[model samples]
Target: MKERIMSKDLMNKIDALGAQEYMSDAQLAVFEEHLRGEHERLIVRQQEITNTSMKNPESISGDEADKANAIQSSADARAESEKNKAMLRSVSVALQAIKTRDYGYCIKCGEEIGLKRMISQPAACRDIECETLEERKNKQNPAANLKIS
Candidate 1:
């Protein structure tokens, strides 16, 4: 059987739990501020990389080594930009979850994810057990990483 709560009771429960048991309003605000800062920084960095020089002055004289070095630098910057983009998405999703009253619960097990874990990684979606299992699976099937998506 399912239980029902009165609106007032539900509100009280929400207040007591603070929507997310582990996350407080102040903490959310702080995290949001940091996330926005990081997002902006990454966005700016990726844009800056787009405008970066493809060759140094020495490379302008047709030096193969300098040309190769410039290519490597561009590739590394692009890789970093991709990494930052992923993190930015995670932060955006975390902020949305915080706003939508789903921030502290584990997506895999529906358990309270705990204050420490949420504080340490605001973008976490699963509990430690689920994450560990996922890691084990990833290690066991390294070929999965090589598959073209």
Candidate 2:
């Protein structure tokens, strides 16, 4: 996903608000809007992928190469759908956090996620430090990060 660019006006507002008042109403609105947009986009893309895959039925009477290609295509679509679903869940959680007035704090450390980080990645639930540490841990032990679902 591309990082959202903060407008100069929003940046100025954030600068004026300071750390103690992080995720001011304006900031939350911005992040909420971005997250909602991403959620809608992912839903549309997932639907498109599903529709396309459905339209391309696997051919049972084709050559072995054609069968293989169809299977690979189906697998690719499934993977992409799964990825979109995961993103949708993240976006939904972020939206819920916004509604609960708990949007900007890091889930792991309880620190402000910072205006710049929230603007750039609206669905983020962790501050950079905690997120970095989690990523490192996941890299070292990938199985620990796997979701059974």
The best candidate by TM-score is 2
**What TM-score against the true fold does each predicted structure earn?**
0.68, 0.80
Q: How close to the true structure is residue 83 of candidate 2, measured as C-alpha lDDT?
A: 88
Judge candidate 2 against the unseen true structure and give its global Cα lDDT, from 0 to 1: 0.80
Candidate 2, 1-149: lDDT as tens digits:
13324344445655655664567787677667767777888999999999978845365567988888888888899899988898899999999999999898899989998877776667889999999999999999998967887
**Clashes by residue pair, model 1:** none
Tens digit of lDDT per residue, candidate 1, span 1-149? 11123223333433555545255675566556655665677678767766673445345555788767767887787777677678878877877877887776787888877755655565777788888988899899988767375
Q: How close is candidate 2 to the true structure, as a TM-score?
A: 0.80
RMSD of 2: 3.5
Question: What is the Cα-based lDDT of residue 15 in candidate 1?
Answer: 52
Candidate 1 residue runs with Cα over 4 Å from true position: 1-21, 53-61, 143-149
Tell me the whole-model lDDT of each prediction, alpha carbons only.
0.66, 0.80
For residue 6, give model 1's deviation from the true position in Å: 41
Model 2: CA > 4 A from native: 1-21, 55-61
Q: Candidate 1: minimum summed lDDT over ten consecutive residues — where?
A: 1-10
